[model samples]
Target: MTINNVSLSHHGGEEASGLLEELCDAYADAYGVEPGEEKTVAFRRRAEKQFSRPGFALVTARDGGRLVGFTFGYTLPAGDTHWWGGVQPEPTADFLQETGSRTWVLSEIEVRRAWQGRGTGRALHDAVLGARGEERATLATGPDAAAQPVYESWGWRRVGRIPGDEGDYYSAYDLFVLELPVSW
Candidate 1:
């Protein structure tokens, strides 16, 4: 699909697995992750796990076939207590009842440095969510202006925070949630 002159493509996790190297390249470019570093390897491993989950999907933005940005995620199953374990304020049981259809967890989103501020990220975000059937979505990013302000501008509200985990890529981050369209 073409959006604002950038070509957008959607893929199931299986197919997306083949593009991990390229996806990582885009990630490294956007975040300054040194090539062949431990963090890069860890990110790849995480991406693999994400791809293997049920309801997984990926969307990529390309400019003449070079990745400019991408977004991907999967739906959470009911009772994923581990996932909710990090939320600062524990959620109520009613809010935790997912039934596997209530939430889509956006695992990764990035726009290459060259493409930043030109709407490429927004385009990729909209393309992915626009294709999702879930009633709502959530994502986590660092709790700072440099990290989450853009998400806030896009309508996500910080519902809570996740304490940093013990890992190279782990850090305390604010959790944001957004409701998807629901026509009565």
Candidate 2:
């Protein structure tokens, strides 16, 4: 696939209506779940509402006018460190509280199965973080050691992992951080 042809857009509010479902479906499929099992209404609702918040931003990847991938995040408030729901499990309040004012918590990054390994993920990451210089950006991913290499290559470091819910059969996750210089 020609990655250069993919366009990125910042979607917000009701504009995020169907995207939560799309992202969740892509994520669930990547973990080998059945179609029906992937459609969690509650998850979708929570994700949609979260993305609609003021500090949140969602970048969508489009190829030939079709949505292929997306990534979203927002500034972490001072009082609350542990934000729950959406694609990420609830983090500890202390884990998030130490971040500076520029702290960013990435909520999700997902590409359709057909579009994997095509640089869409990198494009989304770059588009999202490129504008914020010197801010600390963090994300938590389920135990997929393979993803660690990719993140490290992009300047992120392994920090820690919050315990996964017993309901999460995939694996425990790892938290990663990239302390960017305040040059931007």
Candidate 3:
């Protein structure tokens, strides 16, 4: 079950703008990211870009008004060559193609430390994922992230490793993909 008083809800782009700070703040809490850290800043920037994309959406878990968790992503446009942020060994040309509605990228899913193991993250995940209308979905996860096991159990498969950017804050991550309408 989820933590007491937590409500899961949806937010579109307009509403999402007002929630960026709160969303990033909750992200910092969940990821142990220091204030003003490069990753934190980069996350905000990427989030802003995500907001501008068509079909951007956010799902949040709030404990009676306090942000406890969030997950967001958007459907990729017809051409998003940079979206992968660069994958190692590269993928086949066909695999790199996008039809604007073929893929949904789950950018980030975070649950604050205090809310861990109470089902908040899973509920948020299921809610947002259940809302997607794409043929497939993808996300990046660190080898040691707490959510990795859950993703694996839910049928997400490794695609390839996305190398970290120049900044050290962004470590290399394993890119994962799942076919749409996951049962779990």
Candidate 4:
């Protein structure tokens, strides 16, 4: 279906819970996986936890009430071992010292397969990141993921890679970070 008009809306973490299932389903479908699969299930669980973080933000794109795409993330606390520890080569001391206030981790951004290449993903991504108050944003993307180019085009630079954990879907992912434009 052609999306002639995609309307985007921003919602707080709690307010976005209602659409979680739909968002997860869209994510699975976009990647050609079933929602009940192990990786998808894990992703859903992870998303649920992320939604509870302080400053969590979600942006959904809809076409006449039908969900087309969505993106969400939360601020990363500095010194957080969970994320920084996973990097293959240790990050610079400055990068490791995340007090949890400087960076925003853009956890997920997905669009329905039917909606791919229509700019819906970009719209949703920009809507979420543009609204963020953090100084920089980070995300991990597999080298082969289609969205990698889109991210690069938007100024996300390759910084590093995280060696994939055993049983994870992808073997490794190139990490990307973007210094957000300071808004006056």
Candidate 5:
């Protein structure tokens, strides 16, 4: 599918909440998982929580009025033990300090299966990250995910891995971080 006609838009949390179903559909299609399954259910709940975060942001791409892709994240709370607790190889003290600012946690980026390689995902990812005011951004991806190379190419570096949680969506994932421009 050609993404030449795709349009991108940034949405605030309230607006993004309304797009949850469409976002879940895109995620399900991309991952070959059925909606309402264990992982999908968990994801839906997480997305809802993420949308309510203080610095929540979402960027979406639509092709001819249909949602094709989206990416969303929120600023990480400083000193939030819940997030840092997952780091496999503990990071340095500076990295662990949150101050309720510092890092933007990219929770999810998904494109419909039919739109995988047409740049929809990139457009959405870049749109979301480009709008963040945080000093850096972080995301976790399955160790062998197809997007790993894309993240690396975009200047993200692997920091460590987080062990899988019981009944979680991912078994284990490598954490990646990228420093963002002070001004964008």
Candidate 6:
């Protein structure tokens, strides 16, 4: 199924709730585990709060009225943004403190399982790159062979790795970076 008819739009707080759930569920499912009720509720709450912020933006894809995916990110204090923002169990102060300059951190990218290879992810990623020109782009994903190819294909270079606490949350993740030339 080619995603030739998909539409992309920036999502607001109220408009983002329902669709954000699908994205979060995609995250959990992609991790190969079922999310607990608490986890699901917390994910929505956090996403709502972030989406409420001024600098944060979400790009969503819809096909015939059903949402297939979305990507969201925010401008951090350069020294205060992590690849996943605050999604991980670890506090982001350390991650934020290590930074270069003028860049927006990609908080999340989610595409429905069925729509995985249809360019939904790239469409959303392009939105971010277009919105924030120049400044390096960054994100983290599983280190398994499956995710590496996608990151490389997207032009994201492996920069560093984020260590996580035990509990089966981030056992195979690695951080990747993309140096986007600032087009004046």
Best by TM-score: 1
Q: Write the per-residue lDDT of candidate 2 for residues 121-146, one digit (tens) a residue.
A: 99888877775543688887777767
lDDT computed for candidate 2: 0.69
What is the RMSD, in Å, between candidate 4 and the native fold over all Cα?
2.9
Task: Return the lDDT, model 3, position 117.
Answer: 85
In candidate 6, where is summed lDDT lowest over 10 consecutive residues?
A: 80-89
In order, what lDDT does every prediction score? 0.83, 0.69, 0.83, 0.81, 0.84, 0.65
TM-score of each: 0.92, 0.74, 0.87, 0.88, 0.91, 0.70
Residue 22 in model 6: lDDT: 70
Clashing pairs in 1: none
lDDT of 5 by residue, 1-184 (tens): 2447998988999998899899888888878899877777878999998888979998888888998888999988756656666787888888878877788999899888898888787777777887777888899898899889999887889999988788765788899999985232
lDDT of each residue in 21-72, candidate 6, tens digit only: 5767765554444656655555566677777654567788778877777788
Q: Cα lDDT of model 1 overall? A: 0.83
Per-residue CA lDDT of model 1 for 1-184, tens digit only, reads: 8877899999998789899999989888888877478767887888999998878999999998898999999999876645566687867777667878888998898888999988888888888888889889989776674758888788888888788788835577778888885221
Worst 10 residues of 1 by lDDT: 77-86
Model 4: runs farther than 4 Å from truth? 1-4, 86-89, 182-184
Model 5 clash tally, residue pairs:
4
**Cα error, candidate 3, residue 80 (Å):** 5.2
Error of 3 at 122 (Å): 0.9
**Residue 51 C-alpha lDDT in model 6:** 74
Tell how far residue 5 is off in model 2, in angstroms: 1.3
TM-score of 1: 0.92
